[model samples]
Target: MQRKLAAIIAGDVVGYSRLMAEDEAQTYSELRAALREIVEPAVQRHGGRTFKYTGDGFLTAFGSVNAALEAAIDIQRGFGTCPLDLRLGLNLGDVIEEDGDIFGDGVNVANRLQAMAEPGTIYASASVVRSADKEHVARFRRIGRRQAKNIPEAIEVYAMHPDKAAPNGLARLLPARRLSWSRPRPTVLASICAGILVTGFIAAGSWTERAAAPPAAGSTSGSLRATAADSRPTVAVLPFDDLSAEPSQTYFADGLTEDVIANLARNRELMVIARNSTFALGDQPADIREIGERLGAQYVVEGSARRAGDQLRVVAQLIDARSGTHLWSHSYDQRIEDVFAVQADLTARIVSSLVSYVRQSEAAAAVARPTADLRAYDLVLRARGHHKHGGADRAALLEARDLYGRAVELDPRYATARAYLGLTYISEQFGWPTADAAELVARGLAEAREAIRLEPDLPLAYQVLSFGLAASGEYEGSMRAAQRAVELNGSDPDSLMALAKAQLRFGAYDEAVENAERARRLHPLAPEYYAYIHGQALYAAGRLEEADEVLAECTLRAPQDPDCLKIRAAVLVGLERPDEARAAMTELLRREPDFSLAGEEVGRRFGNSPLMRRFLSDLSRAEAPPSAA
Candidate 1:
């Protein structure tokens, strides 16, 4: 046996035993695939070798501590939306290697640390943290000292901050991959600990208080809004199948289905069928096309849920009911401490996925439909296609505004159309040169209020009102409106995004970043504006690298968007990349020839705040257009 200093990594699947119990062959195959595709590849990439496989876990050795920690981080991120959850631990100490396997206190300490880690997180010994590079060390926070099983002395541990693990360059810009893995069950202690942590993270500040309040007074009673001849695509969410070993778990499945239906109804874009209408068909499986024809739905959302001990597995799919084509599908496996918590999260994820797929499918269909057949809802849908592309396309923005106006004229009671019409005015106020800013702001505010009057529970109306208020310099009112939108529908990405933007304008940078991140998490396939807002929040909070990464994604998605280009240029300047910043500024100037540093537009948006100063300084450094100051 040779003793030498090495960085050791220990990783274990969180619920390996439960996975095997459910399906031994499939579990074994998935474990092998994970090791081969994710774990081993990451290890190799970071100059590590998997020295041993501990059945449901693995032990890896790296010559460098930084490499070991990086490898562990990469492996954890690689799991992404996959059902598998891994706990990783790293230690730097003397190890005994014999016959290509490691042993001794180093390996033992790593195993103990791995056992202590929460699911999808990394824990490292103080020695490892000390040996790591400064950049890597900064990403971890001390977790105090802990006594390891069979170890003589207490060891100091550090946990990596979840948000600090930045994706390399534009990697995070890509759509999340949908991968399947056998579900694992967490230990009782781990489950309770994770539950507490999740609760604390989610229930921070006033948001939880607002979330606990009852729905707004004028909320509808969960009925389908669209009629039989409604131009918008109609969606039906069927009751989820109970795939558990015991039939008693059907309640959980049914509750999840109901929650998903309710959440989808909050989105004004789609006409969601009421739970009663879909659940009336019973739990029997039917052909997608036949179900669509019977229910008069263009799309169908179907899924199954399984409960095993304290763990739950949910598999969902979005289908084009007309063609019986599966548009998207994903599976979620989570440890359940509170059934309602699991239901809420599962519902949000499912609804977000369904909305993205449905919108894409609808937009494609709308493009093919002739203009003569367009109705208020159809016009709004087509308008959204233009609106989401940002204000760089002058013709498109004008077209979207016109379409929204026509939509409102056709159906004055359509709160969704009016809200979007208000949003267009606000967008125009910021994006274009306007002679009567007060009139634009007034019109925007009026439309938003009218929409709210028409439908008080409509989160979109509240979101539009928040934007309009912000543009009118009513920060307090803007915040209240944004908060109300979130309180009404916390799962809606648009609501979260509106709140984030309001928070940013209100000088709550950290809160802005948190809300924007939450929005991105909910809607992985969200439009470019999501990235723009998230990057803006990060930039405001002085997180330059993260802001740079996110803004890069925003520019890639909408290359001509002036807001994205402006922010990207500022971030590049902050990062001290003068040439890149100059390049970005050149592109920005190409898009907006009248851009200027001392323009009233900047003051109108940012006021005299520190963020505005920083934004100006960065732009000035990038050599933006000359100011008339």
Candidate 2:
């Protein structure tokens, strides 16, 4: 019997049973060929040995974590063009080798991670990531803490996509450099690398510090920059040119651009630039490479929309920004009434080209039509335009609300319109001083529920419902709905932000910070509210400095936003900067004269939880105003 620490990899073929059932002989042959041609050579080249081969998968061991990861990545890349879909999981831990078989918690953990991984991807334990080479570390993105079946403690998981393009434009399947290897040593060095797994992973604070560090210079600010390490393809959609006979149809073109961006953003496999950032480029023509560099995007979507009377003609193209190649293009000519169908088709085709494997369910959800009534759809689009430009302007919000109301009346089955209408009411409660708060909350909740009833799968409806529930003091229900929204549309920034907000109110600060950070990454040009939510979560989690920095950005972005001011004051108080805290409170009071710690409104919103009590205590220390009553 022998015991030592080593890096272990567990792999399995996705849909192995179905493949074999369909063609047993062919499936067996392909599996054997993949093992012989791809897996064994990659393992041996990286100084690893394949210890065991299951009928449908294999287990490999390496003396070093780096070697194991390289082998796994190579194997996955090799299978990219093959019929088989492979998922790999890596772990660095102590294992027992007896009679040419390895056994222990280490092997169990690797198998669990393999099972959790998505098809054709790798999931590694935190210990594996921590021990990996810094260069290889860049290839990993933390998915979050996941509890594997029968695992005593949750394991923090990081994922890597093997098929993603390399930064140097070379294929990922390039042969790995051979490593000089002698006998595997069981020594202090191996123990040090395996220490984290023994200790049940690093503290949450440590993980956050690592993740929240500022991005390197020359990378895209506020975004998950697409580098050689992070291979998720980044895309930008510029505002479509309006070639309409009447210039008044420009809004239609802009609406099409926004819809395409929104749909593409829903696919987690691709990073879609926010509408604001891309649209800011306007209708200007420039070098595709330059636009890509500016947006940190590898692909660009450009199009033109022409509307003549009842006939609509739209032309769209997808360009490979790096090589200036037009990968795909399509022209659509349809009645004005079929514009929605055209938008759906355009979005689906773009997604098909960008993602290697597009889940039909997610693609369908992304292009789901809001309403069959053209008038209702047009009204909702106009309302969104007003909302986007309005910010906290009372007149603008009222105008949007009126338009959304008309849309709902025109097509009562329009879930998206009802959801947005509910959002406006909730916005009124926070930003409109003269608005009836209780009435708005009731109306918002009712509208949100109706939207959900109309379309249960609409992520936007669940997000709105979460806000309305939170406002109405249904904290648990609010959290549940927010979770459902994320589950339904994992890549939607709004859904993620809402979940973060709900998590914040429940004192799940770590999760709140994570989700909020994800939302910011997905939509780098996200509104000031994202900052507010993220900052508050950091503050609640006792990360005062990070909270202060994020809140400062929020204040700088929207100087007049009282929510930002309120959180900034709390963070400053925590940092022991009493004068700055008081200054923030003063500014907050200037903007919201009725702001008070002792008010029923504050109590209703924050409740009497320990976290909220601390928040109120901090506000009091900052000399915030007392209730008028």
Candidate 3:
């Protein structure tokens, strides 16, 4: 048995047996279904290992105390307003492993902690508290003392108050970092970092840095110009509130944000947060510094939109995340039909003032859509939301696909529809029965490119092209399309995430990690997919220990995931626990007999060759494997 100190976690349904007795069939069904959907995935996301799947609950193992607390919080959040509740217990100490089940005082303490906990609460021992660097950030308060059965001493406990406080460690920090909305003094330090980051990569063998992000640039400025710490460039774009009651005015607001995003991206000398990340924070009043720090930016852009009959109004502001000062402010009122012209003209002016030598190719695409396509364009925007922003189970994608289909049917030459259709294909692949990865994907991608040809100026064309390319495994091509998409709309988190994944897959390991870190910060609640890039980045950097921890997390955190189980097997093998590794492998093989050792591949897919290398090296190191042989 491997002797190791670990964090043990115990959780159980608040009233499982009683609920069952009340309505055995319905209650059991709901509990089972919810456990699989919400509880299990949350545990995995918070980096917990499943030691046992209780008939109605779970006994989890975590290596890090912080991770254990996080898992509990996530479980609460994932339930999302549901009345279901869970009780949690956690302790950090040495535990003996026997046939994969843990033993000793640590496990006992963990179980006791849960048994004493109230419904919907996480109770952790003092040992777990001391291990945390930022436990206070989660608003977990000391809960006096308790005596556990057979425990030598009384233990101090802590409980998370998720309802009263922000549920995440980082989200808790959001209130303090406000951005100004009326001034115009944008910093350019981030742009320097951006430049240095890009310039560092002009090589045939470009991807060099592996462990951490660009070594903090000793570190490079986001604007790519090295500077003293006091002066750095950063920006954030706030969500534009729609003031119109009809809700139809949303497009005008969304369009404004998109336009501003382009204006920001055009500043080659400045670092910019991708729009998707910024808009994510716009829905609520957020701490700009926290948002900027996480988004990897120095400034923020925020605004609201309203329409009264033919007149449309948009109030926009850009704020410095660090200083909480507004760098610029403006308001526009125009006819609804003229909103397109408003975005184009405003973007053009903002560019002429802030950026010199605006690219002609971009300028051409910035033109407002013709008045004839106004109503149809709204459907396109709605389709965009459905196709991209929505999650795996979001039904909106079907409606989006159909709408885009109709939009093109109504206008055969509409390049946007073609690109959108391509985007929809990528969305459909997330589900098994509804998934059509081959034929539909090919046609969708072809249409994306045709959209580009027909509408070279539209960012959506590039965005769709990027997603199609990535979905098709054209990693390098996808990176190019994604890069172009961001160049066209730097504030779009979706584009950056797409770009980040492409870079990770194509061996641009360093850049991939940097961009992915940025994307994760902007969209912390990224449904399940966030773990993919985060876990891969850890693995690529040879952080196998950490990667194993994260991979185990994916197993439950990501609902209905094929790769979660597969990834666990791969990372365990990397950690040299062949027994645990094989167990994971056996489970995967049950799901897929053709499963290969290539799962060990970090940046690249490992085939039989890497497997042979690993097998030989491992056997050479293990006296038992040889003695048995």
TM-score of each: 0.44, 0.66, 0.51
Question: After superposition, which runs of candidate 2 have C-alpha atoms over 4 Å from their true positions?
Answer: 1-230, 283-287, 359-366, 433-436, 600-607
Output the better candidate (1/3) by TM-score: 3
Cα deviation in Å at residue 103, candidate 1? 72
lDDT of 2 by residue, 307-337 (tens): 8988999999999988999998999999999
For candidate 3, the C-alpha RMSD (Å) to the true structure equals: 27.7
lDDT of 3 at 112: 87
RMSD of each: 20.4, 12.6, 27.7
**Lowest-scoring 10 consecutive residues by lDDT in candidate 3?**
202-211
**Model 1: how far residue 122 lies from native, Å:** 35
lDDT of 1 at 369: 14
Ordering by lDDT? 2, 1, 3
Clashes of each: 2, 0, 50
In the range 1-629, model 3's lDDT, one tens digit per residue, is 87789988887776667657755776566666656666666667777778887787778888888777777776655443333456678789899888988888888888888876655567788788778767443455444345667888766665553452436542332222321112211222333333233222211011111112111211121322211121214445566888889876676677567656655544332344456555666666667766666655655667788878778887776666677777678888877787766666555544443333344334434453632565666667667655564356557777888888877776766776777777777656533324456766677778888888886645677877766665566767877887766544443456666777666656665566555555444343444565555566555556667666656656556534545555555556678787876666556556655434332232132112343355334323321122211
